[model samples]
Target: MSPHHEPPLTRLAWIGMAGLALVLVAMSPVAGQVAANVAVPEPDGYRMENYRAPTPASLRGAQVVDTAQAHRLWNDKAAVFVDVMPRDVKPPNLPAGTIWRDKKREDVPGSVWLPNVGYGVLNAEMDSYFRRGLAGITEGRKDAPLVFYCKTDCWMSWNAAKRAMEYGYANITWYPGGSDGWAEAGLPLEVAKPVE
Candidate 1:
């Protein structure tokens, strides 16, 4: 071998060392954190069951906001904050002429409450209600910034946000923490009524 030339085994060892370094970097804690923060893969369809469980970390075509971000949007009035918590309905089996009273619901102040519109499968009536509610809030502007929420660990907001995306609403946000988070943060809430 010449004075400046290296043996084939030495060059191969150097390449192996470089590959090992790359693997170590990839397995580092910082790298693991980065990987953890990556968006969770979206499900193929709406979450049909277990509505009150931990939801996915992300939704395709929607910005996922935290409690603070949601507050900023509400305080600035930059987006339409929507609460999708379902409302209890009167039982049809009740005696004739029985007076029915709805359970009171408190939500983020100034939020539009669209009850029962967040189900994975909405009937024709609920579908129309959701569509019209969005139209009314955005005044037919498909690009309006809309924030959706329900309760912490609830998947209804996720489904609703996805449905809004399907409806061609250009700007959509999903606040996974929802009202529970807001209240837990000592934020104020007000009684809400479903849109007629």
Candidate 2:
């Protein structure tokens, strides 16, 4: 009831404003990403989502690498680079003069283009096929270094990496910086064709 004392409602209002300011300040670090063309790395303990790819729950066993590590693995003769980006079949109905180009299928040189490898809903047949293909690629060696990638923020590589880990592979690297990341680094890429 004193002139120096603020009313309870006014005090609450001030408290709310202070809380709001703190939240904005904390989020200011990423405000630029919303406006810029830069790729934003996922926060230390949060999921980064894209329209198509959802972030995985845990990457405990799978090591997430950037473009550099990817490059290193690319040179390793024993390392297997798996590009799990799904390939879309061209429509056969296009006119003779019309041109339809395939998706940017070029990957970091020596990468295996595994079309249809990133399906969220893999039936038993496809799942078995994936396991077999992975095994064959690594020559049935669980200790072989395997790198899985697709495109930037693609859940395909994440899923593939996790699947490989579950299959008991000791070293599985998830290159979250997929094809886009590779090309952005000005690294060499080779044209790839989908294997039926």
Candidate 3:
């Protein structure tokens, strides 16, 4: 009689092994948590704005106002609008629909074009300009209600807003939507003209 050896694995055994491995993976707490997180829907409106805890980013620390509310605030003359964009980001040189407006002409009708503090990390000249602009605004009314914003999710506005709050502005609203929100709402925006 010939010596018999075990048969090379059957197809059913392979299938069973795969299914068992899958079940074991699914039972893990890490897998469960990942599935739950994936199933959860993201927030629709701005909820992070009202958070009392320290925020990690720009709009996180400041009030997040909608375009409608911002428009109303502007109409009511309740806010002193300030744009925090660098000179390099404005329109004409950029697209007509570009968000960042630095120059006087590009500024919103009544909004002040104050370059953000710490423009160039290495250049002292740009730093000085930024400091002067910030100091000028914060000198007298450090507690003044000032609204500041840049591009959406862009840190320039967020950093600027945070700096403003640090400077003692009592009320600082960070428009997370920024210029995008303004244009999206069909709100009228004044274009800057060269003062010849």
Give one digit per residue, the lDDT tens place, for model 2 in 1-196. 7746988898899889999998897688577566444444433432223425445434778787878877877866657888888788688898899988887688878777777666655779778878888878888989888888888867777767767776799899888788888999998788897655
Worst 10 residues of 1 by lDDT: 35-44
> TM-score of every model?
0.78, 0.67, 0.54
lDDT of all predictions:
0.91, 0.75, 0.59
Q: With candidate 1 superimposed using the best TM-score fit, by how many Å does residue 155's alpha carbon deviate from the native?
A: 0.9
lDDT-based ranking, best first? Answer: 1, 2, 3
Candidate 3 backbone collisions, by pair: 105-192
Which segments of model 3 are wrong by more than 4 Å?
Answer: 1-61, 89-107, 116-131, 134-139, 192-196
Compare candidates 1 and 3 on TM-score and give the better one: 1
Candidate 3 lDDT by residue in tens digits, 12-33: 6767899999999999999988
